[model samples]
Target: MYMNTLRKRSFQIYADHIRPYKGRVFLSWIFLLFAQIIGLVPPLLYKRFVNILSSGTSMDTDISMLVRIILLVVVVYIVMNICYRIAEYVVVHYVARIMADLNQTCFAYLHRHSHQFFSNNFAGALVKKVNRFVNSFRVLFDSFYWDLHGVVVRIIVATCVLAFLNIWLGVILFVWSILFIFVAFLFIKKKLVWDVQKADQDSVVTGVLADTIANETNVKFFVGSSREYARFETETRTQQYLQERSWMVNYWLNVAQGVLLLLVEFCMMYYAVQLWRQGLLTIGDFVLIQSYMFAIIAHVWDVSHIMRRLYEGFADAEEMAEIFETPHEIVDVKRATTLVVPRGEIVFDDVSFQYHATRTIIEQFNLTILPGQRVALVGHSGAGKSTIVKLLLRSHDVTAGKLMIDNQKISHVTLESLWQHVSYVPQDPILFHRTLMENIRYGKPDATDEEVMEAARLAHAHEFIESFPEKYDTYVGERGVKLSGGERQRVAIARAILKNSPILILDEATSSLDSESERLIQDALQNLMKKKTVIVVAHRLSTVMSMDRILVIEEGKIVEDGSHKQLLRKKNGFYKKLWNIQAGTFIM
Candidate 1:
């Protein structure tokens, strides 16, 4: 079953990338075949020269005749060289182009995948898989172009020549070739599996490193250097052990191949001399066979090497195939259409969701935010607040209900079009390693300089931006690490402001900011949210007190929903109690 799947995937990969260059590839192989045949003429010419030299009569060989033969040989050699070079170039170019297309397709598919796919995968591991897969195309091309096709043609031609001269030597070399191939394949099969295991272990190590760096603040605050290092070392050691084992096996395999080659060489020469002495072959024929035998043997060994390399490529390709072929759990409906400009009415009807096998995050919940209304969600961690945002963004589909935007079912519209009308400000904003202007412009790539500055001003970020020596061009560093929390939040707000969508989602966007920064950002948020459907996930009750309505969520259920004053009047309600606690109006 595994082998069948590998074959199918390999074919799919080839078809996806190689099919476009079929004519070029076919012509290349045809020229390569002709070049291989022309290459055989050199050994034949050398054999004739050897015969003439041994005769000692030298016909006083005509200088012109010798020069002509030498020139002819040189011309054939050059043609062979040029043709093969062209073939190699064509193969490599096609391989590179195909790998690029495959990688792009994989990325596009991943972009459409539901949040669960990303949450369940290690980001670094997936990145490594893509890198390895693209690299494998080069290996695949190298192996097939030079080793598989070229070597096989040369070997076949050489064997046929030897067989016509003497069948005994032909039989011997054929048997040796079969044995050599079998032994090489055995070693390669084992090493390929080992290499894949090593790659997986390496991916785990990389994932750990990514996590450690991403969580550097937590690690440093807890002084967890030793712990993190130990974990990293464990994965590293496993990867090293697997790689070493594979290398050791490959080394011994090459040793065996070398030994077999030496034995074959010795036998071929010995038999060639015997045939010559028996008058079954001329000295020139013997020399020709000997020379061709050496070339053929080298070609055979190279074929074995190429096969081993191919196995490694296949392993990497298979790993990448998983990611490229992964199902997108959230996808547009059949015949999906682009959404018209949104009017900002959002609705969740009887929505249910489960994050894991045993955990249900939301169950049969119904909610609505009318056009131009502002709603705040108050909940503890894992109370389905963020899940609502994810559902709205179509990052994940609802398990058993409907989500709509402006009276249109979200699933019926293309995801790109859906997001065009919605802009989200996440709690932890992600900034690329680029200038501040580039990061802000990411929201609306075509925004003019004046428009960018205007948006920055509205978000209260223009002042600090101007304070920097580079101003808008200042590099934010990795993940905006060079910037303060408030600065990053303002950048995030500026991005949202630039987007200026009909629906706004502030997912604890102000959580990392100081009180003063939050106050300033809050004013910007109000302006941005004007006439838009707004949903705010708030941890601090004070931030959402004046919201048009607040929904208190607990254990995946909406336990209370009302205005602040109305909720405060109900002593038994969760929101009223929470408000009283935060207000410090109740006895501890």
Candidate 2:
């Protein structure tokens, strides 16, 4: 039953990645067949040599005939070796090509995952899974062509040759081969547990390394390097333990396989010797049967090892296959069209969102922002402030109500279309490890160098960017780590300025900048926000005091709303209290 399942999975893998190269694979198979035929010819040539020596010189037609037979064998051996190498060369390249394509497919699938999915998993674990999956083909292909396929072909041809000479010997070989395979299959089923455990352990180690690399700065800041090292060591020790156990078990299995091979060879040799004494076989036939017995022993050992390793590799690759089978949480509806937000109006009516069923972040939220209005959301941390932004962005859909842009439901629109009209400068600066020009032009990929510089100038980023030796062409380290806090935020602002979308979200965009830099950025933001629908999420009240509308949200409900002055006039309003707190005063 396991064999059938393994075959189906193997077929699926081949159909997906290897089906395109079937012609090359078929040709390789032909080459292997010719090599095997030439291989079988050697034993026959040795048999012929034995017969010629057994007979007197008078029995042979001439000495010249013997030389001709020896030369034929030499030429055939050379040709067989060439064919074997040719088959190996072609199949190996094909495996590499298929592996490359499979990795690409895996990457494309992973990259499309929803933000929620990424949040739930580690990037390093995912990367390790993909690497293991691509590399599994190496072991899998080796066991497949060299041992599994090779042994099977060797057995069929050997059996045919033996049966043509004597039916009794052929029957014995076939029955023994069946039982040998059955025992090996049973052992392989048990090895699968160790295979899966080791693969899982490998992923854990990789995830630990990835996590540390991603947060090295934080660990150093808190002086927790040694603590992290201990955690990593613990995981590695577990992996080492699994590896040791796996190796010991496979060693014993090989010993058992070795014993089985000996038994089969002894039986074959005894019968061939008996048949020769009874005059049913020639001296040449006796030699051929003995050679065939040794060949059978070698084939059984190879097949046993390959079968176990093949199944183990199949188990490893299937772990990644399960990830591919997971459905995307967010998908565009059938016939969904582009959403055009010409007026930049947004509405969220009775919207509710929750990451878990037991805990709610936003409940029955209702809000509307008119065209070209500057609105601010001010609240303490964990008051559903960011949830509102995520809902409008459709990172996660609202469970209870509709979120619309220009009267079109965001969920019903193509994600690309919805994102096209919105531009965001997040609290933490995000940049790729690419040139400054590339990062700025990311907002609009086709933007020219001059256009990128213009956007940088508008965001007050041009002065600092041009100061570098490479200027706009300078490489920013991973996540813009090479740049200062204020500089990174300015570059992000420059990227957003280049986008120039109708709807803008500034989630603490200036939080990292000093007072002087914030003032410069604030001036640039004023020009950028002119006639644009803007939503600002702020902790520092100074950032939102001049907004056209101030929304003091508490527990996802709008507790206070109006202009900065109008909301402050309310005696018991939440907005008034927060305003006074920021101003270093208290309101009862």
Top lDDT prediction, candidate number: 2
What are the per-residue Cα lDDT tens digits for candidate 2 across 1-588? 654554466458657788899999899989988897678777787788788878677644746667888899999989999999999899888988998998898888887778898998888888877886777778887787767777777778778888988888988888888878877777777776777788788888888898899999899999989999999999999999888877777777787777877877888778877888888888888788778778876787777678777877776777677676678877788999999988999999889887766678888888999999999998989888888998888888887888899899999999888888999999998799999999999999999889999999988899999899999989999889899988999999999999999999999998898878887778799999998999999988888878999888888888888998898889998877777777862111
Cα lDDT computed for each candidate against the true fold: 0.83, 0.84
Stretch of 10 with least lDDT, candidate 1: 579-588
Across residues 1-588, which tens digit of lDDT does each residue of candidate 1 receive?
Answer: 674486468658767677888898898788777877888889888877777667766464645556777898899899989987887677667767777887887677667777788888888888888888778877787687766877777777887888888897888788888888889989888888788788678778889999999889999999999999999998898988999999998899989999999999899888888877889888889778878878888888886679878887887777777665566787778999998754788888998888654679889989988999999999789888998888889887778899888778888999889988888999888799999999899899999988899999999999999999999999999899999877898899899999999888999888888877777777788888888888999887877877898999898788888888888899688887677677862211
lDDT of 2: 0.84
Clashing pairs in 2: none
Which residue runs of candidate 2 sit more than 4 Å off their true CA positions? 1-14, 59-62, 85-94, 584-588
TM-score of candidate 2 on Cα atoms, chains taken together: 0.93
lDDT value, residue 42 of candidate 2: 76
Residue 11's lDDT in candidate 1: 58
Q: Judge candidate 1 against the unseen true structure and give its global Cα lDDT, from 0 to 1.
A: 0.83
Question: Each prediction's TM-score against the native?
Answer: 0.95, 0.93
Minimum summed lDDT over a 10-residue window in model 2 is located at: 579-588
